[model samples]
Every structure is written in structure tokens, then in C-alpha cells.
Target chain A: MDAESTAASKGALVDLDEATCWSLLGPAGIGRLSWTSGGKPFVVPVNYRVSDGRLEVVTAAYSAIARECDDAFVALEADSTDAEHHAGWSVLVQGTAAIDFQHPSSDGPRPWPAGVRRQLLVITPASVTGRRLT
Target chain B: MDAESTAASKGALVDLDEATCWSLLGPAGIGRLSWTSGGKPFVVPVNYRVSDGRLEVVTAAYSAIARECDDAFVALEADSTDAEHHAGWSVLVQGTAAIDFQHPSSDGPRPWPAGVRRQLLVITPASVTGRRLT
Candidate 1:
């Protein structure tokens, strides 16, 4: 579509549907995940790939973030806004997290990329919801 | 203005200026605050008010969030999205936090509402930035 036509077609507010949210999270490679560990609040930006409708990321072992985040309540979020698209949207997924603690060499998926030493943290969302701007 | 004119006037994307972000955070009263403690992550939904370019909220003394967050890095976030306006925005303020640690008898601001105890946790944002969707 041309720029003018796209601008004309854009809406001012958008209440995103569940399908749209799923699509956005599935294809996006980045988002912030918030959780509670050791009774304190924490947020980390991760390069993540969504799988099974959940957020997945890798972390180093024995680190502060890993140490605190065993069995936690996690929230994931994504949004966008720009000049040509005076609109944006955000989705939040709140869920429980667990470590794929099994060693990577045997049965389960290869959990880490280069420079990733700790176990994998998978956020299995209990409630996934989102909102959009028109 | 009529609906059509307003619609036409709306931009597709908006690169929000600092003034706009300040305005949005200032008037709004709700956001999520994240922090780390004892090697774990934690997050709490708060009813906050911005004061002196920082985010302020109340908490009880001896709380888990209070004990772990001493001299910690905290993040505060706010965003909005809708259908009539297909746009949204997100602002992140990262900073150090501290408790007022004082009783609310004679000197400082009365820190809590009804059902609020403990001291105050004020997030003095070291870096404040935001993005908008057009």
C-alpha cells in the first residue's frame, strides 16, 4: 500500500484480538519479561523466540537473575509506535516460569546459543492478554 | 472538530517528545515497578504519583519487597492502547530506590493512604525514555 493510503486507513485506537497478539509474539524476537525472585521485582530484556505460545530465553547459571527466578510469576510485553503509524499496541502475558534444567546434550531441545551457559527459563503463561492503540 | 478532521489530523506514528512522556507519567496513577532482591526478581503493581521527576509509591516496613530492594535498580513502566486510536506508547524509567524510613508524624509528606504502612519507596530515575506508536 502507498504511504498516503496507509495513513488514511490507519485507525486511532486498536483493541487487539487474541489472534493478533499471538501472531505478534510468535514472530517477534524481543521483549521484556518481569518476574519476582527472592521477594524482589526484576525485569530483563531478552532475545527470545516464542514457542508453544510462551516466552523462552536463556540465562547463565549461578547468576543473580537465575538464582532468584526459580518458580516465578512472569510477565511479557511488546509494543510499537512510529511517525507513519501514529498507533501502537502492547500485550502482557502473566505466567509461571520453570528451568529446563536437564543437560542439553541428550534428549530435550538444545536450550542455549553461543555465550549462554545457565539453564533455560521458559515462561508458560497462565494468562495472556494485550491492548492496542488506534 | 469533526470525526473526519480529527482522524485526518492524527498521525500514523508518533515519536513522542520528552514533554509528552513527562505529561503522561505525571497524571497517570498506575504502573508496574520491578526490582531484585537476595538474588531473585520481583514485581508489584502500584498506585504511584510522580514527584520531582521520579516515581513514588508506598510500602509497609519489613515487607519482602522492602527488605530486598535496598540500593537496587528499579524500573517503572506505563503504556496505553485502544481501538479508535490504533497507536500506543511505552515509557521506561530506570533508577535507584530508597525508603523514606521516617515516621509521618511532623516533618515530611504524609506518605500513605488508608491501609498503607511501612515507609515510602521513591524511584529516582537515572534514565527516563519512552516510545510511541502512531
Candidate 2:
């Protein structure tokens, strides 16, 4: 069975279609970027913008993300939850990250932390999957 | 330099001590769990509770997390951010995960998704690190 059917069997989660996943990713937002470093997984929250079918995040040149994620396979997870209502939707993007110095748009999403975040890492997605909690 | 000094040099990020990291983890809340599967990384949002100096989360027995994370090294990241102010703090827990059928608590955090989520994954943290955006 595929992911959708597997989630369907759970009864509480409904698999979202690819189109819906992209829609929920929105034009810009916050998400968590995860990657393996030194044989252990690391995750950190980041601000991102969706542009030209890719997700882009700016980071300080010396940040761990910039240092470890360039040319790496990573995952970015974004979601919105109403904990009080016990409802939310999450989208996961599996992708290859590369530092995009060539086409770094001047209007891309800025890093939240106060710093000279001049490096832009663009994630070219390999798969986009999502599920909604009912 | 250590993690604290590395972050200090960035100027915009302040390294949070171990005590502060635990304090921010609080008694219970939401976080993102990340681990490697098939040599690739995956991350998902999860509801969690802190107990006995460890973090616990419930997942469907057949869920991806349950299937892949047992006896594995994983990371859990939780944070609070005010997008408008561009300020917030994030805490990261790097640990080992084990399914705790031996001591499944009756009052542990329940899964947000509707399901027979009876399996409890206990994460005994090896390192608790955090940083705050200035």
C-alpha cells in the first residue's frame, strides 16, 4: 500500500495530494530544516520562501545550517496547528540543498535572527508529502 | 571554541545554558522529531511531554516514526517565535529513542491525531542545547 492508503488505515490522518501540499506550503513561512551531521540528525527552525517550485532560506554564513546543509540531502517540515482544537496540517519536503549564490533574489525571505545572513540555501524538492489531522 | 562561544561570536544568537534549555522544554508541549531513515533524513511535528528528565511522545504503532526510531539516535526541536519581532528561542534535544512498554504512563501526552496510539517512545537526551535570537 502507498502512503495515502497507509495513512487512511490510521483513520485519523488523511493524506494530502501533491497540489494541496504545495498550496499549504504557501508563498513564505516558517519551517524546520532537518539534516544528518556526524551520523546524527539535527533540526532547527527557519524562515523560508517558496519560489519557482523551490524553498529558499537565508542563513548567516557561519551558521551550522549553512556549513552542514550545503550540497546535502535534507528535509523541511512545515505545519500549522491549533493545539486547543487538536487539528493541524503538516507538509514535508525531501530535497537537495545548494547554496544559491548565482540567483539570490534581493526580495527573498530574510532570516529572523539579527545577523548578516548573506547565504541563501535553495532546496530543490525530490518529494512533497503531507497529512492533515482530523 | 565550544557551542556557546561559537554562537556568541555570531553576535545575534546567544547560547542558552543547559538549565535554560530544560526550562524552555517545560512540562509538556509540541516539537519536531527528526531522524535518519534509509540514509536520508525525515522530520515530523509531534506532541510531547517532559517526564523524569526525558521527553516522551505517543505514536501509532505502525507509524513511520515508531517503525524507524526505536533504538535510534534522534533529535527533537521545539521553539517559540514572534515573526513580527523576529525574536524567539529554540531548544534542541539530541538523544536515543526507545519504546517504553515497560513504563507507559497513564497520564503522558496523548497523540494529537486520532488513532490507537498506544506506543510510547521515550527519548533520553544526551545533549540539550539551545539558542535565542537577539
Candidate 3:
């Protein structure tokens, strides 16, 4: 509590605007996906790619993500941290998930695992927010 | 698709049992916390510690995690991966979070950001699951 109290008086929270948030998403290909199934929440890491204001990803047709994320509201996050240095930045994208079955995944990030990840999904964000801890 | 098919026929998925799940959690103090806020899912990482089958953490009183995680069902995950080798493992804890105001967060994992993280919380897990991609 001593450290916390002293630190609280000089909070270093920085707000990241929309453009900055998108920029942070630019060089990142892996992120965590949060989604709900039957009213309970779950989170898992996925290989992702973002461009033109949209987040794109693919998963195995029978994987848990493919089964749970169709038409669901989800949040995807990517971050960089240096714990020993006490510095980090995080970006969160909250949106409605839409599965694209027609075109299929052409040229985008692939699944990390050894499998046929045929499920192509896209997220149209309702809001994008980010923050930096300096 | 060619790479996927080859990998699929030789799937490298490995199941991680309860004991292994806890072992992977050892010495790791940071992880992502997933919780639902107003019927939508969200995730943020936090500093966390595990002991005696319980996961303990603290957060700023006014932070989003403190407000949404009390008495709520949440999922916490920690993982390590090597992209070049496609090797990774993840552990997930699903449970009900309880806020302990009387205890007042004494000698536990504290928040990383410089703030008064007074919300002392404990998660009693209902299930612990894990997986390894070799």
C-alpha cells in the first residue's frame, strides 16, 4: 500500500486516440480474443491481422473459436509490455463478429497450430480504445 | 491450405491435465483476465499469483476489472509461445471471483500501473484446463 499510495498521487495513465490505436494494431499479428458462449465468457489467443479498419482472422472449422464466435459480440486485444521496466501499452477492439463463408480466407494470417483452419472471420468494431502505462 | 492439410494429418495437439495446468502457472505473475460486462465480453491482463489452488490479485478500486469481476464468472489465462518453432502452451482457470473487503489486500500480487489497487480479489476455480501445441 505504501508504494501504491505514493504512485497514485502521480498516475501515469495516457489515453490513446483512435488513430494511435489503429497504428499499434499495425505491426501485431497475435492477440487475445474474448467471446461469450451460453452466457459465460472465455478468452484465447489467436493469430490476427488488421487493415482498413477491420480485424481479420481464421480458425479451424471445428475449433472452439469457430463454434462460439459466429454472430457474437467479441473483444480482441494486443499489447506490448516490459515488466521489469514497468512500461506497457494495450489496444482493445470491441465489435460484432461476422463469418465470411463466400470468399473464404485468401491471403491473411494463418493459425499457429498444425491444422486446417478453414473458418474465416471478421470483426466490425463498435468501439476501439487504447491506453498506455508509463 | 497445403500446409494446413499436411499439419492436420499429423496434428500436434497435446492435452494438459490438471496437474500440468497448475505447474505451468508456477512462477508466472502476469496473465489475461476475461469477464463479461453488461452481456458483452472483455479481456485485460493483470498481475496474478497462484497458491493453494487459489488465484489472487488486486486492482484499482475504480478500474473496470474491479467493478466487473466481483462475484462474476471469469476466465484467467497465461501462456508462452515461440513463433519460429510453433511451440506454445496455455492454461485457463474458470471460476467465480469473490471480493474480500475485510482482508484489504495484504502481501499479494499488486497492480502494475502506478495506482491505488485496493480491490483485493480471490478466484475459486471450478475447472482448470490446459493444452500444448507441439
Candidate 4:
């Protein structure tokens, strides 16, 4: 079967182009950061911003994300869904995260949780993929 | 410092008890599924329902989720965030996933995308953790 047929056979979920994926991720919003700790996977919701085409999250220094994500490969996922309409799009950004003390952006993401969220987790995407459910 | 002080030092994000975590996950809705494939982490948004205290997702048989998740340890994350209020709660369910062909649920989650989503992925939680940002 051809690629089109293959996609249709599975569910006809459209594979979004790279540009569309970036467009979906351009707005600063809530996203889930997935990483491995102790050889186990963990996912947590975080407030994020797209700065210079990279994902940035402000977190507490003592939080699990700050402790485990630095210098590690992680995946950040953001999506919007309408349960009533049964339509939405999802974008996935997989990349390496590093602690950036000197993020040049003056307007970075401000985490909602109250505390000294001094540490910045910067994720430079290695791959950006997405799908649209229509 | 003491435990309470330690929590305060981090940012005062309240640690939710297991019962509360279950409560947050009780309603069926959109959640992200995270898993490791080829030593790299991947996260995708999925429609899920909690049946008998277990998380269930319906996906295409040929989808990456169906192929990579069976018998593998994974993490399912669900949350509600109010960007304006800056208040939200997130629940994380970490456990093993198995493809269940015999899911007895008569009212399982129906995939929104157009396709034959016959495979049912059931996640039995090993740990349920959550935090509330007030």
C-alpha cells in the first residue's frame, strides 16, 4: 500500500508539516515535560514559553524537573482539544534540556506556583512533530 | 530545615494526597502518555477514560502508541490549568501499559480521529502523585 493508504488504514490522522508544528508551539502556554529518572519515565505539567525558537520553563531549583531535567533528553508536548467537537491538534518537541542561568529573554515564562523559581530549563528541540485530528 | 520548611523553600506548591490525585484523575478526558522508545522519551496527547481505577486509551493498531507501549512502563499525566487565575492541579500516573483486547468496559473512550482504533491500552498505576498550585 502507498503512504496515503497506510495512513488511512490506521486512522487518517493527518501528519502535520514541520512549519505547522512550530506554529502550534509558538504561543507560550502549558505543556507537559517528559523525562527519565531512575530509568523510569515521568511527565509533569509546566508553564512554558517559546523563546528564540527554544522552549523555556521556569521551575524551582529543588523541584524534580530542575533536578532531573538538566543535561537530559526530554520531550515537551502541547495540544488543544475540543471534546465536544472531537477535533484538536497536538505538537511534540523532543530535545535536550539544560539549565540556562543567563537566558537573554526579559519576558520569560513566569511559573504560577509561588516560590523562588530561579532555575530555567531550556529545551532545544531536536525534532518537532505533530498530528491533527479532524 | 524541617519538612514543612523544606516545602516552603521550594515554592509552597502543595503536595496532593493519593486520594486527591485519584479524584483528579477520576473524570475521563484528555491526557498525555509518556514512554521511552530507543532510549528516548516521547509524549503524545491521548483521549482516555478511567475504568475500574485504571486508565484506558483507544488507539489505532498500527499507531506508535500501540506498538511501543505494550508491557512497557509509562506515565500518564492529566491536569487542569487556569492561565488567568494561575491556579491548577496536575496528576501523574506512572505504571505499566498492556494492550487489553478484553476490556469489559461498555462505555470506553472513543477516539476522535477517523480510524479503526481497536486496540485498547490499559495502564495500571504503580504510583499516583499530584501537586496543587494555589
Candidate 5:
């Protein structure tokens, strides 16, 4: 699109509410997960689910991420924009992370949501913050 | 926009090229900078510039990021979508980070692109990877 066209199509802004924010992430199968490795930060894209006000994600136990979680703070964020770029909201959750090794491991007909995975990254929020771009 | 409209307007995909990836970020003032804090991960939005094949971002010396950069790796990424959602590209740089203590400290005219501030997050990527969504 041309600069003029792009500027003219900025679109209408949508007001953000708790319901809207929840809706944006409820079905978004993908989100970015960030963590620190040896002091610097690393961000990895992963499939996630929101359950009980926190994000529950599964990863391979032998993944580099699991090997590096040395009892430090971590966060997860998800965002999406509409066709007009008029409305979008971002939810950020900050909290402690742990490996839920006891998580179920099964791939039956009715798999548990994100499949039966042996490893789980459980994020317990110390703070839940969100923002909407209007 | 309704779900049907959103799906119908996925737009025409754009061909990927190195020049296109560079151009998308060269002018976009905002990008996401991710790093590890403690043992978890954090993603922060900041205004950045593409300079010398690496991402140069500035922050306060006392910023939590600065304190946490205790000899570790870091990464920076930028992405943008067009009106049609048909084309976009993302550039990710992974590298070692160091503080440029002697970085120019000034707000003078043409102040070195991203302004002269207290701290600099110099991401010298061991691997610079990029992807384009067409």
C-alpha cells in the first residue's frame, strides 16, 4: 500500500476490556515465551493455553529451555491485530516457573487440550498486567 | 472485523527478499527486545534502529535489564504487517551483549540515530537468522 493509503486506513479504534483481552488469547494457539539464559534473555515461540489466570505450556524435558531454568523470573505475552490495525490487545504475565514432571503423558482420542506431554512449564503469576493498543 | 472478514482478508502474500526484510525495520521506530531476567524470560517493547548489521538499543544504566546483563546472551527482533496481512517479515539476531560505557552521551542534533543515552545493548549475534511471511 502507498504511504497515503496506509495512513488513511489506520481504521477505527476499539475499546479494550477484560472480556476482549481474554478472547484474544483464548484461541491463539501460539505465543512468545521468553526466558533468561546465563544472564541474557531468549525468546521462543511456542503453543500455549491460558488456564486459571496463568499460562500453561508444554516442552520437551530435554529442551534447552528446561535445562536453563535455574529458578529465576520469567514471562509470557500474546498479541494480535485486526485487519484494519484498529484494535489489538496484549497480555503480559510475570511469575515464577517450574517443571511439572508429573503432567500427564498420553495421546489418547480425547487428548488433554495440548496433547499428553510429560513436561509442563507452569507459570504462577506474581503480577498479571495487560494493555490494549487503541 | 468479523471472523469471516478476517479470514477473507488474509491478503496477497508478498515475496521474501533480503532487501524487503531490511526495509521493513529500517523505518519502523518500534520493535521488541527480549532477554532473560533471573531464570525466566522478559520481552520489552522499545524504539530501535538497524545499524551495522546489529541492533543498537539504549536504556538507563540503572534499568533492570542493565543490572541483569551479567555476561550473557541477548536477542532483538522486529516485525511489521501491511494492510492486507499478505506480507511481513521478522529478523532475529542472537549474540553476546556488552555495555558500551563510552557510548556517546548527548542529545545534540542528529544525535547518533537512536540518541545518545546512558546504556547500550550491543547484540553481537553468534547467529543472525531471519524469516519472511509471504
Candidate 6:
């Protein structure tokens, strides 16, 4: 809760500031995208890039994520861990997703396992919050 | 979507078999839980353990996860990656959640951030699926 790392022990979750949260979001490069469809919640890992506060990701037209997430409210999360020390940090963004066809293909890194990533999903983050396990 | 890793070039998503999916989920101990409340999606990082196909997790009673997830449909994911190789695997479990007061505390590891984790949530996975970026 406190910004001071001293107040937190290993594995203690500390609430992160907005600035720190966004800073973490940038370098993580990849994260999980969570969305709901037909009353079932689904979390899919995505190759993403954050630029100007918007999260950009590429998904196949037939992938579950693209099928369920476009034009829907979704959550994107990225995190890192120091497994040896049992510590880590996670950033979660709650936002609305839409197909950004106009987004240039060069905007971010393409999804791995290269395929027809015809749909470009952009999540305009409405709230960004994070926590660090120190 | 083929199971053959070769057919899936780097970034091409390959659908994973059920057995492989569970295997990957076990070693990847931490993942994001995606849930919906008030029609908005929330994804929170959780330290989880898998036993006999059940996903067991602990959450602070006062935290957002416990408040919105009990007795709800939720998804738990676990995965791993070789960042240098630009390849990874992700597993998703869609299931129902309930407050398992009778669940033995000995069932799984305690939540990080030593605090009041008053709720024990058990998700009886209805569907288990996965994909690998090979």
C-alpha cells in the first residue's frame, strides 16, 4: 500500500502509482487479455505494445480473443517476476476494445507464430492500476 | 490452429492438446484471473496451485477479486514463455467459482502480500483449452 518498498516484505503487494503503472506497462511487451462471452470469462495471452497510453495487439480473425473481444469491454494485464525471490509486479488496464483497421501495421510488433493477423484490436484504457509484490 | 508446431510458424497460434495444456498450467504457477462484474472485465494476477484438475486460489476478502468473483463464472490462466525465442504457451480454464469455506487451507499456497485473505475460491473447470506460439 505504501510507496516505500521498506514497508513491504518479499511477496507483499504494494499498490502502484499511475505513473509507475504506465511505466511498467511499456516494457513488459506481452500480457493476458481477459474478456467474457456467453457467460464464460476467458483470458488469452497476447503480444502487445503500448504507445501513447493505448494498448495495441494483433489477433487472428478466427482466434477466440478476436472472436470475443472486438467491440467489447476488456482487461489487459502485464507483469514481471523475480521468481528466485518470489516477487513480482502486475499492471491491469480496464478498457473498451475496437478493431483499429486504420492503425498502421508498423505501429507495434507483429504477433508471433506468424499467421493471418487480420484484426487489430486497440484497447483505449479507461483505468490503469497496478501492484508490485516486493 | 493445428497441433503441429511446425505448421505454426513463430507467432502462429497452435491449438494445444488437453494433456499438454494441463501440463503447462502446472509449471506456470502464477496467472491472471479474468472475471466480469457490473459488465466490465477485470483481470488480476493470482498465485495459484493446481491439484487433481482443480484450480485453487486465495484472495483477500476486501480485495476486488474476492468481492466480485465469488459464486461467479471466472477464468484462470497459466503460461510460460521463452522471451528470447519469441515463443510461449498459454492455458485458459473457464469455470464456476464458489467460496469454499470447507476447503482445507492446506490445499494451496497462501496469497502474496501477507494480509487477510478471507476467501478460498475454487473453480471447477468446465472447459480447459490452450495454445502455443511455436
Per-residue error (Å), model 6, residue A7: 12
What DockQ does candidate 2 score? 0.41
Better of 2 and 3 by lDDT: 2
What does fnat come to for each candidate?
Answer: 0.18, 0.65, 0.57, 0.67, 0.36, 0.73
Candidate 1 lDDT tens digits, B14-74:
4566777788787545566677544433454455777767677766566655775557778
Residue-by-residue lDDT tens digits, candidate 6, A1-134: 44344235535678999899998887538788888788777787788877677888887678777778889999988888776777789988999998877866545656776755667888999889998988
Instruction: Output the better candidate (1/2) by lDDT.
Output: 2
lDDT of 5 by residue, B3-122 (tens): 345435443323445565566667435556676654556675555655676666676577655776535577766665432433455565667777767767332111111212367666
Relative to the unseen true structure, what is the C-alpha lDDT of residue A96 in candidate 1, on a scale of 0 to 100? 76
| Candidate order by decreasing TM-score | 3, 2, 4, 6, 5, 1
Q: After superposition, how far is residue B49 of candidate 1 from its true place, in Å?
A: 1.2
Clashing pairs in 4: none
Candidates 2 and 5 compared by DockQ, better number = 2
- C-alpha lDDT (0 to 100) for residue B131 of candidate 1: 63
The runs of at least 3 residues in candidate 6 whose Cα sits more than 4 Å from the true structure, single-residue gaps closed, are A1-11, B1-11
User: Per-residue alpha-carbon lDDT of model 4 for B22-108, expressed as tens digits?
Assistant: 888776888899999987899988888888888999877889999999999999999998877778889999999999988643347
Docking class of 4: acceptable
Ranking by DockQ: 3, 6, 4, 2, 5, 1
* Best-to-worst ranking by lDDT: 2, 4, 3, 6, 1, 5
Every candidate's lDDT: 0.60, 0.87, 0.81, 0.84, 0.57, 0.79
Docking class of 2: acceptable
Model 2 clash pairs are none
Model 3, docking class: medium
Poorest lDDT segment (10 consecutive residues) of candidate 5 chain A: A107-116
Runs in model 2 deviating more than 4 A are A1-11, B1-11
DockQ-derived CAPRI band for the predicted complex in model 5: incorrect
